[model samples]
Target chain A: MAATIEDLAQAVFDGDSRKAKKLSQKLLDAGEAPLDIINQGLMGGMSEVGVQFKAGTMFVPDVMAAAEAMSAGVELVKPLIAHEDIQSLGTVYMCTVKADLHDIGKNLVIMMLEGAGFNVINGGVDVAPEKIVEDVKELHPDIIGMSALLTTTMLHMKDTIELLKEEGLRDQVKVIIGGAPVSQDFADEIAADGYSPDAVSAADLAKSLVGAA
Target chain B: MYRTRSLYTTAGFQVQQHLFWQMLTDDQCEAIVSTAEELLERTGVEVLSEAAVKVFEEAGCLVDGSRVRIPSTKIQWALRNAPSRVTLCDRKGNRAMMLENNEAHWGAGYTPTEYYDQEKEEKRPFTLADVEEFGKLAQMLPNIDFATQGGFPTDVDEAMAEVYAFKTLVKTTTKPIVQHVRGLAQAQPIYDMAVAVKGCAKELAFDPFVALHVSIEEPLQLSADALEVITFAAEKRLPVIVSNELVSGFTAPAESAGVMIVALANSFAALVLSQLVSEGTPFITGGFFTNNDTVNELHPVGSPEVSLLGGGFANILRYLRIPSYGFGGATDSKISDAQLGLESALSTLCAGVAGTNVIAGAGVFESGLASNPNLLVLVDEMACETERIMRGVEMDEDRLARGVIEYVQPAGNYLATKHTRYYFRSEQFWPTLMNRKRIDDWAAEGSLTLGQRTMNKTKSLLVAYSPKALKDDVVAELDKIAG
Candidate 1:
């Protein structure tokens, strides 16, 4: 029998990791494409969790467990998918800025980006401007994601962007900034390409900026 | 037993001894202060209301358009009469003071919208039931002295959810409740319920036990609805925590001290307005400041500038002789992992040392975007540890010498001595979940991270906790109000 989207989605939501993985593998083996399993089964399940989360019908641990189950299934099918056919929207570099070693926001953006089909390079906390520039030069990523949890270190982003401009690399990269203190007005003031209030919006913006939406 | 001495000065001021001393020599701090003062004088604070502007002008502050230059003398005068200590009264009659000295009380606060998703985890919106669960959990924790109704519950109507959460909070725990007065229509019902539970008609209004937070986005820009809430709350004699959230480099100034002074001026203006509206209305002055560090230029929480801003605000509050509210236990870390521990510990320690009262920002993750029951347990542990630190080491020669001499001269071990048994428990707050077990014991149980242990503890609480039942009449009234 062909598995329905609801059945696959429910398996992920129920936190049945073994079943979620097995189902995804079986579906792939039976001729269902990997992207279909991801969009219909995994992302669909996460969307329900988000609503429950927003509605208070679910709690954090429940959502966390479900996400883990979904991730397990996704990992199982990832290797079977071809690169060009993977339907990834674009590449983005994300980091928590220097002297401010907080990564929760960056990590969320990463997860959201992955869900939206963007390849993410997570530069861990207290990332120096030089390192970001170096990554930009080497990877030539479409977007640079910078984060800071401290007001003192937030100024570093401005400096980083200025350095990129001085190196004549500003036009090559679209810069997106976020954290507790960031705002759209600030983004404009800092000459950043975009600003997002939260991770979901960040993903949406990433897709839009890359002309993938 | 070791006694924790009060670091607060004789005048009931909890001075930031370290930060203040640092400020004396730090040119950066001095420059920021001067620049901030200039901003205040040149730009002036925008008074949200014409009446508030009139009040300041009449009070001798220089008013030029929307910006009002509040001279340092005026600022100092306004602070002089601000009450240093106020008691927070609970429905059951138990109360805690928003102490004047550096004796801070730590508790969990409202969750931000995006907390759990960043950790690759999911935290759903809070509900009345979840609030009730949180209240029970908070009461069981020795460190959390008070609790607020967690942020917007998605399951129920927003207003109804808030009311139910408050009602459940009051019923479940004896800890003083920090409340918010909804729009004018809902205020009376909230007051009535508070009165029914607390035993005073004006108890919710005048009692220090029920402090209300009034949000001011910018200097002088109080929303009309917020003003109405404050006016109503003040008439009842309740203390108000007049606070502003400044997004430094965006809302105020890029310089840390510059941002602080601007926030301080606005906070002072709000408190003065509150006092003017009704005399003898106790107030706490504080603000939230964050560093704007992002490549996209979106503000994120848990920046060092934010911590410093918090610390600076705590000091100013102490200097102004008002109880201070500062953010603590919040980190930019998405998970209840190693990063959470470090960020929470540092931020809390800073607040504690600065002697903040009404310390908030606990049980939140992902830069205040989400709330976690398990994280609350860990945050409580961090608060307890900070309290222990603020208590400081007993300085008397007898206790210090007793152990050393006894071990050197006497043949007996201090571990078995009378002093050790009496003092050890008081000196250390043994964490309920943080593992301190031997390798063999830890191995036997399968070594668990602090997060796992807290999760287990939370599960046990949820299973065992029977929330305090509200009286039938009260329940009926609450349901009707919620409906």
Candidate 2:
């Protein structure tokens, strides 16, 4: 029997990445659309994972295994996703603000956002506010994610936001801020669209603000 | 209802204690030791060093390539030669800690990538100066018995980090040090620096002020680096803890008995190697066990199973009567929070109750990736609490308080009695971070939580403390060696 999308989802939920990869590759070989495979097979398993994680039925390693399975299938199908496809992902631009050499958190957010199927463009660490505004202009990203580990460097996030407003791109792009010292109040004070404490929440926040969620 | 056990302190003062904590039965311990010995005999450990392999082969262990299958008699021979206790001295030539029966000493982290900056309140890559300040803080803390560099300095040349770290510790703290030398090439410079600080090599070796920490990779593989350091430390007569990374559900089996087998085999291999190098070398053996589960918002370092393994492993060590080490008071949280408090307190208690000698890794958080002075103070307080618990309820007549009870009848006030005044200070656990004030009093003091209080305490300790500087000539010598 040809494995259906439900069978692919079950393989993903079981964290059997080999099965998930093979099944997903088979589905694509059988003339299934990449979008349909991802949405029904990969995301379907992920949604169940979200429920299980929330209900305490799944652990972090379990969740990670499932994510790996989904990522395995997504990696196979995402490249086949055409540029003109109506389901194409919105772009997310990430950077660690000025004077902050720390980028572990920022890099994690980039990796996770990419895993969530966003086209993440990292601007690298210690980026000045002007460079951030320039990247936003050049990229025309749907979302801007800025991070700063130090309180001294966190002011650069506010500067980047103010630059966006000055350049009249504030309404064009939604801004999200995150890091260890960054707080929701700081985000509100800086007039950002949202603040996320970590990578997972940052991905969700970016999705909802871009209307992807 | 508790039976009393009479014990004597190191100072020979008699005390009464009542508590019997056990994580494994006698039969279970015997099974573990014998099985681990059998596992070694059946499946040999991979010895990376060719010279060490020759030494092992000479001792009649069956060698196939790098794999050396150790005989049980070899382990028994190693155990006979190794000391049951190790005495460590401070940099000032003061005897600091005795890693032996009925005692556990606390200390800070040795190797971490990042450090929590107090002024910035954020973690960043550690610099040479950060270690000096952190070492100073550890020296200042009343409960921290030994000091470590706390973080690897990124600013220095990679090869000189260990030497420079030892230099910083020599300058900042008079406490005993635990140094992590990554390779044998980096080992001699640290030893030379310590010798310079303590006058001569023989003097330093006689009453060692520092201990070497070397790691054995799990799945029963001893790396060349660990082998060289153990051999060097054995020849130098310095204490060395040849530890293994026993991450449950990853490295060793999650089952208790199986965990013991691998943990013991790896440690015993190191012990045999150390004895093989130099008989009567002060050697300590233990593994860093983390129960790799994040259930209930706990880090692996803070997980209850690490403590469970610690308690069980401590008993196993006692059963073998080997002076041992155990890890405690670590967390995965980036900042001090409820989770941090829970993790630190539980793991620290397990180490103390299990009577682990040299409870290591006090200041570490973020699963040992980062060190924070605030967490160090928090763990110091936890160590104090562990001391109180280990004191147990004294079962003497005076402690039974018959005279006090007769002096003050029911419904009478003991607060005004001499007994209350005499014993209250020692009997009650006085918390430094915990607030037990009236609600208004707490709010009046800015409504501080325990984390905030811990931070405040850390800052004040740093402010009020000034470690005695080394002599100018000694400083110059250390700097020359460091360079």
Candidate 3:
């Protein structure tokens, strides 16, 4: 046999992203369908990772590595996928809001979302609401995730939502808010669709919002 | 029949009282001060406040915009004028603490935002109640000599939190407080409160109850607020602790010596400011120093480098004959774990040996951002260990006990002897909360962890705590001043 899908799955499961990319290219050269390599080989390994993570046999970093490997394999097949199917689950626009330069939590959510095979556009730290609204209009993401470490900057998240509503883009995507100072009540009062305490749960919330979970 | 004697009774063993261990050589200490002096002359300091710049200018120092270049003689004059020994009194005007020699005083760190509740195993913004409880705990704890405004209370007005915390501390404990204030504006109310407690401003000035701490901006700078407080402290005749923050490879040079020079220079600048304000203001000099984790790029507060730098700084300050303020009994670990134990022990040991005066950073965790009462209880145990280590071996004929050794030489032990009883209580260090149970006994009693045992001990301490009440008249005066 020239190569098997099992080899690709093994590379991804081992979190060997470089090897994953190489093996994925080999499978494609062997005339394997790109979708077959993704769903069966990459996602298959990731599914196992999710199971192991829930079972407590695998940790967050391990899952992250597996997700990274899956992402590497998926990058090889990305050009071949149909435009509508580019983001397998959904796309998210993430940013730590203006006047809050803190990014530890925001970056965590971005990593978690990307690991779950979502296209994450990390709108960088100290991001203004206008810039986010402009990006939201251009990207038309499936979910908008806002984070702020400071209580003052958290208000800007509400302002961003208001701008989204004014621009008539509120109905198109779900709004998810989180951070150290952010509470569920704050989210509810601001008309956010969902809220999560931490990154992993935020990824799950993003999945559920897009009807993928 | 011979009676069985256990060295460790209910809790654990203790180290006998000893002298603080020294880590650096005399030549090394002299080099550090020289380096600090050179840096001060070459780099100068950015004094942000116009008033402070004016003061520096009037003191015959060269002022270029905000930067003030003070010659070595100016610093020497300030050092000579500044009181080397500061006596901090309790509210009753009793001289409770003398900050001199190589004596180390373990106290709490100031303004931690989060308080870790052991019962719930959760961290939340500390309320005024937590501040009050911390005061009570500090008052009751044997190892903690003084208290700080432990945390910012969420319930109180954000601007007034420091004064409120001070009010709570003054009421809850009679221990001398190292008050953390915002600016000269806030210092007035705190000064008034101290004056009320000590019967008058003149009496408060003569026997200072609260010592103010002001931090300088890193890389040779002082904020307007800091200068204001320094001036007020100088005028009020209260002791002031000038601290600086220097993270290796970030705010300061990656070299350990460079970081020390930066910190000490900042303290020297503050000393100059204080002397110009008033020639004989009592001052302590030291600051925060920790190496940046080269790989993670994070400031690990409990790094071994922190211990080395802290210990080195203490030695240098001792050589300078100024009271030293440095970190001790704190950890970078977020939770109670082996890492916490190791880091806290190492830092406390280094601080104890190095002779850091007014050693703070006890109970602080998560790299100085959070604090817990239980963690404080554990850190107290570590302080006791440091105290014992610092005490070292008390070498004398009585300690040797040649006659007693001969008497118990062959078969009999020293149990039930008058010499043993007389020396047993003083010779051995007894831990109040440390677990020393047999394996079976420990497992049988539910296999509690050190954290659990500490929580239990902390709870009892809080329950058993009875505040040494401030008189109603004093309370009324305090409330009026705070308002």
Task: List the candidate 1 regions with Cα displacement exceeding 4 Å.
Answer: A1-213, B1-42, B50-74, B114-120, B159-161, B180-189, B203-207, B402-407, B410-413
| Two-chain DockQ for each candidate model | 0.01, 0.01, 0.00
Identify the CAPRI category of the predicted complex in candidate 1.
incorrect
lDDT of 3 by residue, B173-265 (tens): 998998877787667788888888988878988988789887775788888999999988898888988887689889889988888888888
Give the interface RMSD values of the models in order. 19.2, 25.6, 27.5
lDDT for every model? 0.70, 0.81, 0.81
TM-score of model number 1: 0.61
Give the per-residue lDDT of model 3 (tens digit) for A44-161: 7777776776665654556556767888888778789778755568789998899888775677678668767788999898889899989988998999999998888899989999
TM-score of each: 0.61, 0.66, 0.66
N/CA/C clash count, model 1: 40
Query: What fraction of the true interface contacts does model 1 reproduce?
Result: 0.00
Instruction: Output DockQ, candidate 2.
Output: 0.01
Q: What's the lDDT for residue B311 in model 1?
A: 83
RMSD of 2: 28.1
- Report the C-alpha lDDT of model 1 over A101-202, residue by residue, as the tens digit: 777668767776876788889888898888899899999899999988778988889989998998889999999999877777778899999988666568
Residue lDDT tens for model 2, B47-144: 99998899899989999999999999999898888999899999878889998885888887776778876457688888888788778887888888
